[model samples]
Target: MNEIDPFKLFLELQLALPRNAPGSARATREAFSLLPALPPRPEIADLGCGQGAEAFELLRLANGRITAVDLFEPFLEKLAERAEREGVPETRLRVLRGDMNDLPFHDGEFDLIWSEGAIYLLGFEEGLRLWRRFLKPGGFAVLSELTWLTDAPSPEAAVFWEDAYPGMGSVASNGEAAARAGYRLIGRIVLPTEEWWQDYYMPMRAKLAGMRRTYGELPVFDEMEREICLFERHADEYGYVFYALRRD
Candidate 1:
Protein backbone atom coordinates (compact mmCIF):
# COMPACT_ATOMS: atom_id res chain seq x y z
CA MET A 1 0.00 0.00 0.00
CA ASN A 2 2.94 2.34 0.67
CA GLU A 3 6.48 2.75 -0.70
CA ILE A 4 9.06 1.87 1.95
CA ASP A 5 11.86 4.36 2.55
CA PRO A 6 15.25 2.77 1.88
CA PHE A 7 17.45 5.12 3.92
CA LYS A 8 15.11 4.69 6.85
CA LEU A 9 15.34 0.95 6.51
CA PHE A 10 19.13 1.11 6.23
CA LEU A 11 19.39 2.97 9.52
CA GLU A 12 16.85 0.72 11.17
CA LEU A 13 19.07 -2.22 10.33
CA GLN A 14 22.42 -0.61 11.15
CA LEU A 15 21.93 1.54 14.24
CA ALA A 16 21.15 -1.28 16.64
CA LEU A 17 24.43 -3.15 16.15
CA PRO A 18 27.39 -2.95 18.57
CA ARG A 19 29.64 -2.14 15.63
CA ASN A 20 28.68 -0.55 12.33
CA ALA A 21 31.73 -2.17 10.74
CA PRO A 22 34.25 -4.95 11.17
CA GLY A 23 36.48 -4.32 14.20
CA SER A 24 37.21 -5.40 17.76
CA ALA A 25 38.85 -4.13 20.94
CA ARG A 26 41.81 -6.38 20.24
CA ALA A 27 42.22 -4.81 16.83
CA THR A 28 42.01 -1.38 18.36
CA ARG A 29 44.60 -2.29 20.96
CA GLU A 30 46.96 -3.66 18.35
CA ALA A 31 46.59 -0.58 16.21
CA PHE A 32 47.19 1.69 19.16
CA SER A 33 50.25 -0.26 20.15
CA LEU A 34 51.75 0.37 16.74
CA LEU A 35 51.66 4.11 17.09
CA PRO A 36 54.58 6.21 18.40
CA ALA A 37 54.36 7.57 21.90
CA LEU A 38 52.03 10.45 22.70
CA PRO A 39 51.17 12.71 25.61
CA PRO A 40 50.71 10.90 28.92
CA ARG A 41 47.06 11.81 28.56
CA PRO A 42 46.43 12.19 24.87
CA GLU A 43 43.56 14.20 23.41
CA ILE A 44 41.72 11.99 20.92
CA ALA A 45 39.01 12.38 18.35
CA ASP A 46 36.90 9.50 17.11
CA LEU A 47 35.22 10.58 13.89
CA GLY A 48 32.18 8.89 12.42
CA CYS A 49 32.06 6.84 15.58
CA GLY A 50 28.98 4.69 15.14
CA GLN A 51 27.96 3.45 18.62
CA GLY A 52 31.50 4.12 19.93
CA ALA A 53 33.07 0.66 19.65
CA GLU A 54 36.66 1.85 19.33
CA ALA A 55 35.99 4.79 21.62
CA PHE A 56 35.16 2.43 24.45
CA GLU A 57 38.31 0.44 23.75
CA LEU A 58 40.36 3.65 23.75
CA LEU A 59 39.00 4.27 27.25
CA ARG A 60 40.73 1.14 28.50
CA LEU A 61 43.93 1.59 26.47
CA ALA A 62 44.80 5.25 27.01
CA ASN A 63 44.73 7.84 29.72
CA GLY A 64 43.56 10.47 27.26
CA ARG A 65 40.15 12.08 26.93
CA ILE A 66 38.15 11.22 23.81
CA THR A 67 35.75 13.40 21.87
CA ALA A 68 33.53 10.95 20.03
CA VAL A 69 31.81 12.69 17.12
CA ASP A 70 29.06 11.37 14.88
CA LEU A 71 26.44 13.19 12.88
CA PHE A 72 23.64 10.81 13.77
CA GLU A 73 22.04 11.73 17.06
CA PRO A 74 20.73 8.23 17.48
CA PHE A 75 24.21 6.65 17.26
CA LEU A 76 25.55 9.27 19.64
CA GLU A 77 22.65 8.57 21.97
CA LYS A 78 23.43 4.88 22.05
CA LEU A 79 27.11 5.59 22.69
CA ALA A 80 26.06 7.89 25.53
CA GLU A 81 23.91 5.22 27.12
CA ARG A 82 26.74 2.73 26.86
CA ALA A 83 29.15 5.21 28.35
CA GLU A 84 26.81 5.87 31.24
CA ARG A 85 26.22 2.20 31.81
CA GLU A 86 29.98 1.58 31.83
CA GLY A 87 30.51 4.35 34.37
CA VAL A 88 32.66 6.42 32.01
CA PRO A 89 32.66 10.07 32.96
CA GLU A 90 31.68 12.73 30.47
CA THR A 91 35.07 14.33 30.99
CA ARG A 92 36.83 11.18 29.79
CA LEU A 93 34.64 10.39 26.80
CA ARG A 94 32.49 13.28 25.61
CA VAL A 95 29.90 12.30 23.04
CA LEU A 96 29.22 15.01 20.48
CA ARG A 97 26.80 15.08 17.58
CA GLY A 98 28.84 16.49 14.71
CA ASP A 99 29.71 15.94 11.08
CA MET A 100 33.11 14.48 10.23
CA ASN A 101 33.21 16.52 7.03
CA ASP A 102 32.67 19.76 8.91
CA LEU A 103 34.05 19.11 12.36
CA PRO A 104 34.01 21.95 14.91
CA PHE A 105 37.26 21.16 16.71
CA HIS A 106 40.19 23.55 16.52
CA ASP A 107 43.31 22.78 14.52
CA GLY A 108 46.02 20.72 16.27
CA GLU A 109 43.64 19.72 19.03
CA PHE A 110 44.17 16.02 19.29
CA ASP A 111 47.08 13.70 19.86
CA LEU A 112 45.26 10.91 18.06
CA ILE A 113 42.37 10.57 15.59
CA TRP A 114 40.61 7.21 15.44
CA SER A 115 37.87 6.14 13.08
CA GLU A 116 36.73 2.56 12.73
CA GLY A 117 34.92 1.70 9.46
CA ALA A 118 33.27 5.07 8.88
CA ILE A 119 35.61 7.25 6.84
CA TYR A 120 34.23 6.17 3.47
CA LEU A 121 31.49 8.80 3.70
CA LEU A 122 34.11 11.41 2.68
CA GLY A 123 36.18 9.22 0.38
CA PHE A 124 39.41 7.70 1.70
CA GLU A 125 42.00 10.27 0.67
CA GLU A 126 39.62 13.17 1.20
CA GLY A 127 38.90 12.15 4.77
CA LEU A 128 42.60 11.75 5.60
CA ARG A 129 43.43 15.12 4.05
CA LEU A 130 40.56 16.94 5.72
CA TRP A 131 41.23 15.53 9.16
CA ARG A 132 44.93 16.38 9.08
CA ARG A 133 44.31 19.77 10.63
CA PHE A 134 42.72 18.27 13.68
CA LEU A 135 45.81 16.36 14.71
CA LYS A 136 48.66 17.78 16.70
CA PRO A 137 52.16 17.46 15.28
CA GLY A 138 53.23 13.81 15.25
CA GLY A 139 49.73 12.72 16.24
CA PHE A 140 48.21 9.49 14.96
CA ALA A 141 45.05 8.54 13.05
CA VAL A 142 44.02 4.93 12.89
CA LEU A 143 41.14 4.03 10.60
CA SER A 144 39.62 0.80 9.30
CA GLU A 145 38.73 0.81 5.63
CA LEU A 146 37.57 -1.78 3.12
CA THR A 147 40.61 -2.45 0.93
CA TRP A 148 41.21 -4.65 -2.06
CA LEU A 149 43.60 -7.32 -0.85
CA THR A 150 44.11 -8.80 -4.28
CA ASP A 151 44.42 -7.41 -7.77
CA ALA A 152 42.18 -10.04 -9.28
CA PRO A 153 39.00 -10.42 -7.33
CA SER A 154 36.33 -12.79 -8.53
CA PRO A 155 34.07 -11.24 -11.16
CA GLU A 156 31.13 -11.26 -8.81
CA ALA A 157 33.05 -9.47 -6.08
CA ALA A 158 34.53 -6.98 -8.52
CA VAL A 159 31.18 -6.20 -10.05
CA PHE A 160 29.53 -5.74 -6.69
CA TRP A 161 32.14 -3.30 -5.40
CA GLU A 162 32.36 -1.40 -8.68
CA ASP A 163 28.76 -0.45 -8.14
CA ALA A 164 28.90 -0.06 -4.38
CA TYR A 165 32.33 1.57 -4.11
CA PRO A 166 34.01 2.29 -7.42
CA GLY A 167 36.81 4.09 -5.63
CA MET A 168 37.88 1.16 -3.52
CA GLY A 169 41.65 0.76 -3.75
CA SER A 170 44.16 -1.93 -3.03
CA VAL A 171 46.28 -1.68 0.10
CA ALA A 172 49.23 -0.14 -1.76
CA SER A 173 47.08 2.47 -3.44
CA ASN A 174 45.54 3.55 -0.14
CA GLY A 175 48.95 3.70 1.50
CA GLU A 176 50.15 6.03 -1.26
CA ALA A 177 47.01 8.09 -0.83
CA ALA A 178 47.71 8.32 2.86
CA ALA A 179 51.22 9.54 2.08
CA ARG A 180 49.87 12.24 -0.20
CA ALA A 181 47.53 13.25 2.59
CA GLY A 182 50.50 13.96 4.90
CA TYR A 183 50.70 10.76 6.90
CA ARG A 184 53.49 8.28 7.33
CA LEU A 185 52.52 4.67 7.88
CA ILE A 186 52.99 3.49 11.42
CA GLY A 187 51.52 0.05 10.75
CA ARG A 188 48.57 -1.60 9.03
CA ILE A 189 46.80 -4.83 9.82
CA VAL A 190 44.18 -6.66 7.80
CA LEU A 191 41.26 -7.35 10.06
CA PRO A 192 40.69 -11.07 10.51
CA THR A 193 37.52 -12.49 8.94
CA GLU A 194 36.08 -13.29 12.34
CA GLU A 195 35.89 -9.57 13.13
CA TRP A 196 33.51 -9.17 10.22
CA TRP A 197 31.21 -11.89 11.51
CA GLN A 198 31.52 -11.47 15.25
CA ASP A 199 30.03 -8.00 15.55
CA TYR A 200 29.05 -6.69 12.16
CA TYR A 201 27.76 -9.00 9.43
CA MET A 202 26.58 -11.80 11.73
CA PRO A 203 24.43 -9.46 13.74
CA MET A 204 23.38 -7.78 10.54
CA ARG A 205 22.40 -11.18 9.19
CA ALA A 206 20.22 -11.82 12.19
CA LYS A 207 18.52 -8.46 11.80
CA LEU A 208 18.13 -8.84 8.09
CA ALA A 209 16.68 -12.30 8.62
CA GLY A 210 14.10 -10.94 11.01
CA MET A 211 13.37 -7.98 8.72
CA ARG A 212 12.75 -10.12 5.63
CA ARG A 213 9.00 -10.51 6.15
CA THR A 214 8.66 -6.75 6.38
CA TYR A 215 11.32 -5.52 3.92
CA GLY A 216 12.13 -8.54 1.78
CA GLU A 217 11.01 -7.10 -1.48
CA LEU A 218 13.04 -3.94 -1.11
CA PRO A 219 16.18 -3.58 -3.21
CA VAL A 220 18.18 -2.75 -0.08
CA PHE A 221 17.42 -6.20 1.24
CA ASP A 222 18.73 -7.83 -1.90
CA GLU A 223 21.76 -5.57 -1.88
CA MET A 224 22.67 -6.51 1.68
CA GLU A 225 22.22 -10.20 0.99
CA ARG A 226 24.48 -9.93 -2.02
CA GLU A 227 27.06 -8.11 0.09
CA ILE A 228 27.12 -10.85 2.69
CA CYS A 229 27.34 -13.47 -0.01
CA LEU A 230 30.24 -11.67 -1.65
CA PHE A 231 32.19 -11.40 1.58
CA GLU A 232 31.53 -14.99 2.56
CA ARG A 233 32.73 -16.40 -0.74
CA HIS A 234 35.52 -14.04 -1.79
CA ALA A 235 36.90 -12.86 1.48
CA ASP A 236 40.55 -13.17 0.48
CA GLU A 237 40.04 -10.67 -2.30
CA TYR A 238 39.29 -7.86 0.10
CA GLY A 239 38.93 -6.98 3.77
CA TYR A 240 38.78 -4.16 6.31
CA VAL A 241 42.35 -2.99 7.04
CA PHE A 242 43.29 -0.99 10.07
CA TYR A 243 45.79 1.61 8.90
CA ALA A 244 47.79 3.15 11.66
CA LEU A 245 49.34 6.46 10.56
CA ARG A 246 51.06 9.49 11.92
CA ARG A 247 50.79 13.17 10.93
CA ASP A 248 53.89 14.21 9.01
Candidate 2:
Protein backbone atom coordinates (compact mmCIF):
# COMPACT_ATOMS: atom_id res chain seq x y z
CA MET A 1 0.00 0.00 0.00
CA ASN A 2 1.21 3.52 -0.76
CA GLU A 3 2.00 5.58 2.33
CA ILE A 4 -0.28 8.58 2.93
CA ASP A 5 1.09 12.04 2.41
CA PRO A 6 0.87 13.79 5.75
CA PHE A 7 1.11 17.30 4.29
CA LYS A 8 -1.78 16.53 1.97
CA LEU A 9 -3.71 15.24 4.93
CA PHE A 10 -2.98 18.45 6.81
CA LEU A 11 -4.40 20.53 3.98
CA GLU A 12 -7.46 18.29 3.82
CA LEU A 13 -8.04 18.85 7.52
CA GLN A 14 -8.08 22.62 6.98
CA LEU A 15 -10.48 22.58 4.03
CA ALA A 16 -13.86 24.34 4.18
CA LEU A 17 -13.31 25.82 7.63
CA PRO A 18 -14.83 29.29 8.18
CA ARG A 19 -11.27 30.59 8.62
CA ASN A 20 -7.81 29.12 8.74
CA ALA A 21 -7.02 31.44 11.62
CA PRO A 22 -8.69 33.42 14.35
CA GLY A 23 -10.59 36.49 13.14
CA SER A 24 -14.07 37.95 12.74
CA ALA A 25 -15.99 40.39 10.57
CA ARG A 26 -15.98 42.77 13.53
CA ALA A 27 -12.18 42.77 13.65
CA THR A 28 -11.86 43.30 9.91
CA ARG A 29 -14.25 46.26 10.05
CA GLU A 30 -12.46 47.73 13.05
CA ALA A 31 -9.18 47.77 11.13
CA PHE A 32 -10.74 49.23 8.01
CA SER A 33 -12.45 52.01 9.98
CA LEU A 34 -9.07 53.28 11.19
CA LEU A 35 -8.05 54.19 7.64
CA PRO A 36 -8.67 57.61 6.16
CA ALA A 37 -11.45 57.90 3.61
CA LEU A 38 -10.73 55.75 0.57
CA PRO A 39 -11.44 56.68 -3.02
CA PRO A 40 -14.63 55.22 -4.45
CA ARG A 41 -14.03 51.56 -5.33
CA PRO A 42 -10.38 51.65 -4.30
CA GLU A 43 -8.14 48.84 -5.55
CA ILE A 44 -7.28 46.26 -2.92
CA ALA A 45 -5.22 43.07 -2.68
CA ASP A 46 -5.67 40.35 -0.09
CA LEU A 47 -2.71 37.97 0.32
CA GLY A 48 -3.06 34.38 1.49
CA CYS A 49 -6.79 34.84 1.50
CA GLY A 50 -7.78 31.42 2.82
CA GLN A 51 -11.48 30.81 2.09
CA GLY A 52 -11.75 34.63 1.72
CA ALA A 53 -13.52 35.30 5.01
CA GLU A 54 -11.59 38.53 5.43
CA ALA A 55 -11.88 39.22 1.70
CA PHE A 56 -15.68 39.05 1.81
CA GLU A 57 -15.66 41.24 4.88
CA LEU A 58 -13.46 43.76 3.08
CA LEU A 59 -15.83 43.87 0.13
CA ARG A 60 -18.76 44.50 2.44
CA LEU A 61 -16.98 47.30 4.28
CA ALA A 62 -15.06 49.15 1.54
CA ASN A 63 -17.12 48.18 -1.50
CA GLY A 64 -13.77 47.88 -3.27
CA ARG A 65 -12.54 45.55 -5.95
CA ILE A 66 -10.17 42.90 -4.57
CA THR A 67 -7.46 40.71 -6.11
CA ALA A 68 -7.46 37.84 -3.65
CA VAL A 69 -4.15 35.91 -3.92
CA ASP A 70 -3.31 32.51 -2.49
CA LEU A 71 -1.15 29.52 -3.42
CA PHE A 72 -3.87 26.96 -2.86
CA GLU A 73 -6.29 26.58 -5.78
CA PRO A 74 -8.94 24.94 -3.64
CA PHE A 75 -9.12 27.99 -1.43
CA LEU A 76 -9.58 30.28 -4.41
CA GLU A 77 -12.28 27.97 -5.77
CA LYS A 78 -14.05 28.00 -2.43
CA LEU A 79 -13.81 31.78 -2.27
CA ALA A 80 -15.33 32.02 -5.74
CA GLU A 81 -18.22 29.78 -4.69
CA ARG A 82 -18.81 31.77 -1.52
CA ALA A 83 -18.67 35.03 -3.44
CA GLU A 84 -21.35 33.82 -5.82
CA ARG A 85 -23.52 32.43 -3.03
CA GLU A 86 -23.34 35.73 -1.14
CA GLY A 87 -24.05 37.87 -4.22
CA VAL A 88 -20.67 39.56 -4.21
CA PRO A 89 -20.54 40.71 -7.81
CA GLU A 90 -17.86 39.14 -10.00
CA THR A 91 -16.49 42.57 -10.80
CA ARG A 92 -15.86 43.23 -7.11
CA LEU A 93 -13.84 40.09 -6.42
CA ARG A 94 -11.15 38.27 -8.44
CA VAL A 95 -9.54 35.15 -7.04
CA LEU A 96 -6.01 34.40 -8.24
CA ARG A 97 -3.60 31.57 -7.52
CA GLY A 98 -0.29 33.23 -6.73
CA ASP A 99 2.51 33.35 -4.23
CA MET A 100 2.46 36.21 -1.74
CA ASN A 101 6.25 36.69 -1.86
CA ASP A 102 6.20 37.39 -5.59
CA LEU A 103 2.88 38.98 -6.45
CA PRO A 104 2.09 39.57 -10.11
CA PHE A 105 0.77 43.11 -9.71
CA HIS A 106 2.83 46.16 -10.58
CA ASP A 107 4.28 48.68 -8.15
CA GLY A 108 1.86 51.04 -6.43
CA GLU A 109 -1.06 49.07 -7.79
CA PHE A 110 -3.25 48.78 -4.73
CA ASP A 111 -4.85 51.30 -2.42
CA LEU A 112 -5.05 48.69 0.31
CA ILE A 113 -3.44 45.32 1.04
CA TRP A 114 -4.92 42.99 3.63
CA SER A 115 -3.83 39.69 5.13
CA GLU A 116 -4.81 37.63 8.14
CA GLY A 117 -2.81 34.88 9.85
CA ALA A 118 -0.63 34.53 6.78
CA ILE A 119 2.16 37.12 6.89
CA TYR A 120 4.11 34.94 9.28
CA LEU A 121 4.89 32.69 6.32
CA LEU A 122 7.16 35.51 5.10
CA GLY A 123 8.42 36.58 8.49
CA PHE A 124 6.72 39.68 9.90
CA GLU A 125 9.37 42.28 9.02
CA GLU A 126 10.24 40.74 5.65
CA GLY A 127 6.61 40.62 4.57
CA LEU A 128 6.12 44.26 5.54
CA ARG A 129 9.10 45.36 3.46
CA LEU A 130 8.52 43.10 0.47
CA TRP A 131 4.84 43.94 0.07
CA ARG A 132 5.24 47.67 0.62
CA ARG A 133 6.16 48.21 -3.04
CA PHE A 134 2.71 47.12 -4.18
CA LEU A 135 0.98 49.83 -2.17
CA LYS A 136 0.20 53.24 -3.61
CA PRO A 137 1.48 56.23 -1.65
CA GLY A 138 -0.56 56.48 1.54
CA GLY A 139 -2.12 53.11 0.79
CA PHE A 140 -3.15 51.03 3.79
CA ALA A 141 -2.14 47.46 4.71
CA VAL A 142 -3.78 45.44 7.45
CA LEU A 143 -2.59 42.07 8.71
CA SER A 144 -3.09 39.80 11.70
CA GLU A 145 0.09 38.14 13.02
CA LEU A 146 0.86 35.78 15.85
CA THR A 147 2.32 37.86 18.68
CA TRP A 148 3.62 37.51 22.16
CA LEU A 149 1.09 39.11 24.45
CA THR A 150 3.12 38.93 27.66
CA ASP A 151 6.77 39.58 28.36
CA ALA A 152 7.19 36.05 29.62
CA PRO A 153 5.26 32.97 28.55
CA SER A 154 4.97 29.65 30.26
CA PRO A 155 7.65 27.09 29.49
CA GLU A 156 5.38 24.81 27.50
CA ALA A 157 3.97 27.58 25.39
CA ALA A 158 7.39 29.13 24.90
CA VAL A 159 8.92 25.84 23.75
CA PHE A 160 6.12 25.07 21.36
CA TRP A 161 6.14 28.50 19.71
CA GLU A 162 9.90 28.73 19.75
CA ASP A 163 9.88 25.67 17.53
CA ALA A 164 6.81 26.72 15.57
CA TYR A 165 7.39 30.49 15.24
CA PRO A 166 10.64 31.73 16.70
CA GLY A 167 10.24 35.06 14.89
CA MET A 168 7.20 35.94 17.03
CA GLY A 169 7.61 39.17 18.98
CA SER A 170 5.61 41.52 21.14
CA VAL A 171 3.16 43.97 19.57
CA ALA A 172 5.50 46.87 20.29
CA SER A 173 8.28 45.25 18.29
CA ASN A 174 5.93 44.61 15.40
CA GLY A 175 4.89 48.27 15.39
CA GLU A 176 8.54 49.27 15.18
CA ALA A 177 9.04 46.88 12.26
CA ALA A 178 6.11 48.52 10.49
CA ALA A 179 7.72 51.93 10.85
CA ARG A 180 11.01 50.62 9.54
CA ALA A 181 9.20 49.23 6.53
CA GLY A 182 8.01 52.79 5.64
CA TYR A 183 4.50 52.42 7.00
CA ARG A 184 2.89 54.32 9.84
CA LEU A 185 1.21 52.20 12.47
CA ILE A 186 -2.36 53.40 12.55
CA GLY A 187 -3.57 51.04 15.31
CA ARG A 188 -3.33 47.58 16.81
CA ILE A 189 -6.03 45.24 18.08
CA VAL A 190 -5.55 42.13 20.19
CA LEU A 191 -7.96 39.48 18.97
CA PRO A 192 -10.14 38.28 21.79
CA THR A 193 -9.62 34.63 22.83
CA GLU A 194 -13.27 33.87 22.23
CA GLU A 195 -12.83 34.67 18.55
CA TRP A 196 -10.13 32.03 18.32
CA TRP A 197 -12.31 29.46 20.01
CA GLN A 198 -15.37 30.30 18.00
CA ASP A 199 -13.87 30.73 14.53
CA TYR A 200 -10.83 28.44 14.42
CA TYR A 201 -10.11 26.15 17.31
CA MET A 202 -13.58 24.79 17.99
CA PRO A 203 -14.11 23.82 14.39
CA MET A 204 -10.59 22.45 14.22
CA ARG A 205 -11.30 20.39 17.34
CA ALA A 206 -14.29 18.77 15.72
CA LYS A 207 -12.32 18.00 12.58
CA LEU A 208 -9.45 16.55 14.53
CA ALA A 209 -11.81 14.14 16.26
CA GLY A 210 -13.04 12.85 12.93
CA MET A 211 -9.52 12.70 11.57
CA ARG A 212 -8.43 10.62 14.55
CA ARG A 213 -11.12 8.08 13.80
CA THR A 214 -9.93 7.75 10.21
CA TYR A 215 -6.19 8.14 10.49
CA GLY A 216 -6.02 6.22 13.76
CA GLU A 217 -2.45 6.96 14.93
CA LEU A 218 -0.35 9.39 13.03
CA PRO A 219 2.42 11.62 14.40
CA VAL A 220 0.88 14.66 12.76
CA PHE A 221 -2.32 13.97 14.62
CA ASP A 222 -0.45 13.88 17.91
CA GLU A 223 1.27 17.16 17.13
CA MET A 224 -2.05 18.79 16.31
CA GLU A 225 -3.59 17.57 19.51
CA ARG A 226 -0.65 18.93 21.43
CA GLU A 227 -1.15 22.30 19.78
CA ILE A 228 -4.76 22.36 20.94
CA CYS A 229 -3.71 21.47 24.47
CA LEU A 230 -1.06 24.15 24.52
CA PHE A 231 -3.58 26.77 23.49
CA GLU A 232 -5.92 25.70 26.22
CA ARG A 233 -3.10 25.98 28.73
CA HIS A 234 -1.43 29.19 27.56
CA ALA A 235 -3.91 31.28 25.64
CA ASP A 236 -3.19 34.30 27.83
CA GLU A 237 0.49 34.48 26.89
CA TYR A 238 0.08 34.98 23.18
CA GLY A 239 -2.52 35.77 20.52
CA TYR A 240 -3.22 36.95 16.99
CA VAL A 241 -2.82 40.74 16.71
CA PHE A 242 -4.19 42.92 13.94
CA TYR A 243 -1.99 45.81 12.84
CA ALA A 244 -3.21 48.60 10.63
CA LEU A 245 -0.50 50.35 8.64
CA ARG A 246 -0.26 53.02 5.95
CA ARG A 247 2.49 53.51 3.39
CA ASP A 248 4.21 56.82 4.07
**TM-score of candidate 1 versus the correct structure, residues matched by position:** 0.97
For model 1, the superposed segments whose C-alpha errors exceed 4 Å read: none
The Cα error of candidate 2 at residue 132, in Å, is 0.4
For candidate 2, the clash count comes to 0
Q: Any idea what lDDT model 2 has?
A: 0.90
- Put down candidate 2 lDDT per residue, 1-248, tens digits, no spaces: 67889978888887836898898888888878878899898999999998898888888888779989999988888899988888877699989999988889899999999999999999999999999999999999999999999998998999999999999989999999999989999888899888888878888888888988987878988898899889898899999999989999
Candidate No. with top lDDT:
1
Looking at candidate 2, what is the lDDT of residue 34? 77
